[model samples]
Target: MVTGVEMRQIDRYTIEEIGLTEELLMENAGQAFVNHIISLLDKKKARIAVLIGVGNNGGDGFVISRSLLEKGYHVDVWLVPPVSKVKGTARYHMDIYLKLGYQVNSFETISATGLSQIFMSYTHIIDALLGTGYNGPLRSPYREIIEEVNRSHGNILSVDIPSGLSADGNVDEPILAVKATHTITFQCPKLSSFLFPFREYLGELTIVDIGIPKRAIDQISSERFIWTEEDIIQTLPVRKPSSHKGSHGKGLIIAGSQAMTGAPILTAKACHRLGAGLVTLATPETAHQAIASQLIEATFHLCPSENGEIATLNLSNEVLDNRYDAIAVGPGLGRSTKGDFIDTLLTSFNKPLIIDADGLYYLKNFLPSLQMRKGVTVLTPHVGEFAYLMNEPIEKIEKNRFQFSKQFAEKYGVYLVLKGPYTIVTTPRGKQFINTTGNASLAKGGSGDVLTGMVLALIMQQRDVQSAISNAVFLHGKAADYLTRNGWSPISVIASDLVTIMPHVLEQYQYS
Candidate 1:
């Protein structure tokens, strides 16, 4: 989970509101840094070489030197520029170190060759050369030093962020970023830590609490979110002991055509396995036998269509009156034939709707009308489908997925699930949930059908749209996680295999 920080605002508070007194914050930050280092290393064997710059980050290195010295560990401080150039809290800490009889190496005293030789002796390197305040490309002594640090075999622990990468935007150039084994960041994790390119530079991240007041955090409002297990667990629906098949609620799956019966079968089977008391698969009459044979537990509702194609469907008033907790449409339902079928279903169905695949095609054509539905609607779309629905290119959607999802949800007043590596769920109320589960194993065919089924089942079980989406996404990713651990390829695990694994995954999360 990442907690993003606004660097400019934080710097402003530290400099202005905090009264420029480095003694308090620097002391806390340095002590926290020492605590982490102590936890990683043994006192008898720990030997650390600290790299210091002219800024506050360098001051942190100076303070860390004092802390390690007091603990009886061999510590060496290398100040990059001349000690006279160091100012502010950094110079203050350097003077204190010198007064306390600790040796501080100056850039002028040591030649490049001498510095290289000194760097070879340390087991671990502490990177305080540049902090989050650095912008643009590197220059001069710092650039040269970073190159040497990268070449060194010692493990580097970057302070806050890895030095050369931008804290906010895209960094273009072959800048040398610290290859830290662990980064001890203060307060919240930076946005760049989660974004790509820069994310590669940030190894394993550990956000350390530096006692920033909660009131200060509250003042900084951000729309981004990272979902955890605890965040979704409480939202799952609790089943009653007396719950019967009908009590769990019914889900209507209107999917598949003549040659595409497998899509609805996969969806209906998953819905049944996910604890939907009753699942009814509504497809063309010609495909009824195939769906029924595969989904033995689910009831079949045969709708009239043209020549085994889903060109049109006659859903009468009586069928609409029958209570269904949720309805899922589209999944291998052919685009050419099922376009009208989709339009009719959207206009007539007043239940919770799960729209995916071919249904998205029809919805895209008549989005304004579909958006006016009174019932709660969930649109599940991969990048291509999402782009088509929004009348934009795929690249635009991928670049600004979070913003696009949020805007789409707000525009339609419905829940939008932008499916991909990081599946984003956005609600009409402006809340966003970024899913962290699932892997490359889930990037196979029919996975979306299985997800639609699971989400529909959860919604039918009386869970809120948000809860249903979160639980469905988590469970889907968890299933992939299981396959990954068991050494099963995603291509080998069919949609039915996902249904069989659902019980075990749910049991792992079940409380006594």
Candidate 2:
């Protein structure tokens, strides 16, 4: 079930399918908008300017102006086109404002000096000029007004999306979008707001409750998702006091070579910290000492190798029969070990698997076997790794991350976590969860390895595939967010730091 906040995206359908008039939706949207502004400003003496266009967006501006006037605030309404050109709900609202002894002016009639005088007088600028319907490039008077607003230096607020930004995706050479201090977007956040490049245009976003019916949203299907803390808390695995270490589950991590033993060590440590009862690391025989010395909590399995890399080994029934909750491979595990150890593991293991880095590289070579696995599998691939697995160019993956992530999950019938600025979690069931925590400090090396460990740990703790992936991704990023706030640099936030902070981060969800 979605929260009432998520249902606001259905307002459009409520107007069209459910027989509710657009005018009523508009009034509710406008009143909600006014309420948010009042909560921010709260009786502070300030002059407000409302910049509106000709469509329903302008209609919302008109309603806001009427509501503000009723509240006894000094307000000026500037319509892009003449008042006569306004139509539908916009025209109706304009008529109401005119009858209420309020003045509405056209941009054309105001001279350059007059526009400057108007711009300098307002403390808060309301940009009701564009809504989600905007497509392609911005044009003419709207473009000029957007440029003026960009230069105004006044605090600006956008209605749905910042004007000039594409509602569906990023636009090349986008005209100056409104630099909103805060954006009161109706319903769901647009796809563009989650992507890079254009995400900067949307300021601190606030989704206002506009009374859109829930049935309308349930009828629609979308792969995009936004995850909240409650969502994570609900999915957490229940732990019993009677449970022992073996009952919780055992996870085997095959990672780290000679020069990169730290990667696997980080992954194993994170898994143990996240409550994986028994954690083991399979590494090149030469690196066993380093991993064993550092991570006393995890057992080490020495694997045969040449030059600090593990060679492909035959998987005996003895190895496969041993109970393991899950298996994770490929963080700093070199590509040239033997004739595909990753392929050997995939064909042999029938347990839950978490694949990252070199493991993802090996999977790219044998993607057909991805569907053949008899057990649950989660693939955590960064953009480049994802590109290799999908056989698509990196540029193409970056441009359409949401589509590619969803496609890969459905194609392989496994959970996929496409890690980046906003990590996207896609499940075989077609549900998508977008994680919003984490900052630039997570851009350092070994961070991905830490994330891999956390996911495997959750799986060992008996969390479902979706819950394991979602909660792990959220906490992994949130750990970095906490460290970043404490002034930890990207370079200084090593893998061990993430493990140290896990308990504090997990505590935040206990009450939920």
Scored by TM-score, the top model is 2
Write the residue-wise lDDT of candidate 2 on 10-123 in tens digits: 665687789888888888889999998886664467778899998888999999999998998878888898777889988887888889888987898766667777787888
TM per candidate? 0.84, 0.94
- Tell me the tens digit of each residue's lDDT in model 1 across 281-364: 888888888777777888877777666656555667457648676789888787665376566666777788899998898787
Worst 10 residues of 2 by lDDT: 1-10
Model 2 per-residue lDDT at 328: 92
lDDT of each: 0.78, 0.81
Q: After superposition, how far is residue 87 of candidate 1 from its true place, in Å?
A: 5.0
Local error of candidate 1 at 166, Å?
A: 3.6
lDDT of residue 183 for candidate 2? 87
Give RMSD to native, each candidate.
3.8, 2.7
In Å, residue 5's CA in model 2 sits off its true spot by 19
